[model samples]
Target: MFRTAVGAVGLLAALAAVPPASAESNSDYSVLIISRERLEVATSCEIGVYLNDQLSGRVFQEQSTSFNLPPGPVDVRLRLLPGQMPGCAAGIEDQRSTRLNLQAGQINKYRIAMGHNGLELRRASLGY
Candidate 1:
């Protein structure tokens, strides 16, 4: 009887060492849609969109893209297209990032625009 009790305790300990299921299992996700507003500058270059330090999508002028992400803090970045051209601003090597805390089952909208330093993301209205 003592041996059976000890074995049961060992089994419980082993189970406890295992990690729980991923947050994706029982967690909700947020729908993020990023829109690239049409600007007179750099109309020819396709902007690169990064999520969590990874390239997620490429956006064109007046284009919109969507991503479904788990509820948490997300890192978003934008990369300007390489090379210089007329009407396009120089300095395509600078990178900018924004931290967003998203909620589950919520829709988040953003607009990417050309700033003095680089590309920036701003919370936008629904119709924008």
Candidate 2:
């Protein structure tokens, strides 16, 4: 009985020395939030959000989406996606990309706005 108890205690100590497999450290990533809560575009078409030239998410009016990315520079692009609505076809607008620097453990928020040239992203406060 004493040997079994000692073995059990040794196993417990070994288990306690290792960390859980599901443990994730949040400091390794940064949060990116894109919102389209305003009527700046004044269109009903869904906007395609691209990261590193890849489509990551889509946002419509009064909607928002977020992503957790590694700490580095990320290319962000916004364009109107061809949807079920009229005049919402591809190749109708200039496709431009913007570069954003992301830091570790930081939250960045941006809102869609109509720029002088085309659709763009503008920095927004976190209160919303």
Candidate 3:
């Protein structure tokens, strides 16, 4: 009888120690950005992607890093950082920025010519 009581107490403790299930509505969405002509590695260009006129994140092709952004409308702007300044800005007549229109759980990508090195902003087409 004592062993049974001990077992019952242990069982009760174990049950109490169990973690409760979480009740959270997970946001299901993801996106990935790639250059139009494929950005070269070890370059000085800095790619800045914005979402809904908001700053999402910047990507340096030299150091491969993932930009974590929630699924939604994103406005992307590609610019050459201070170091990659001349090539992206100098002589290049077209460095226009681009505005991206995306939805939840969708991947909106933007492509630009390496020559046009200004700020070409355009509306994102959710084609694929």
Candidate 3 Cα outliers beyond 4 Å, as residue runs: 1-27, 36-66, 84-97, 114-128
Scored against the true structure, residue 55 in model 1 reaches a CA lDDT of: 89
Error of 1 at 54 (Å): 0.4
Model 1 per-residue lDDT tens digits across residues 1-128: 99999999999999999998866633478989998765633567777789999989988778889999989999999886554545445464666589999998888999887778777887888873
How well does each candidate superpose onto the true structure, as a TM-score?
A: 0.67, 0.82, 0.42
Per lDDT, the best of the predicted structures is: 2
Q: What pairs collide in candidate 2?
A: none
- Against the reference, the lDDT scores of all candidates come to 0.81, 0.94, 0.52
RMSD of 3: 7.1
Q: What's the candidate order when arranged by decreasing TM-score? A: 2, 1, 3
Best by TM-score: 2
Inter-residue clash pairs, candidate 1: none
TM-score of 1: 0.67
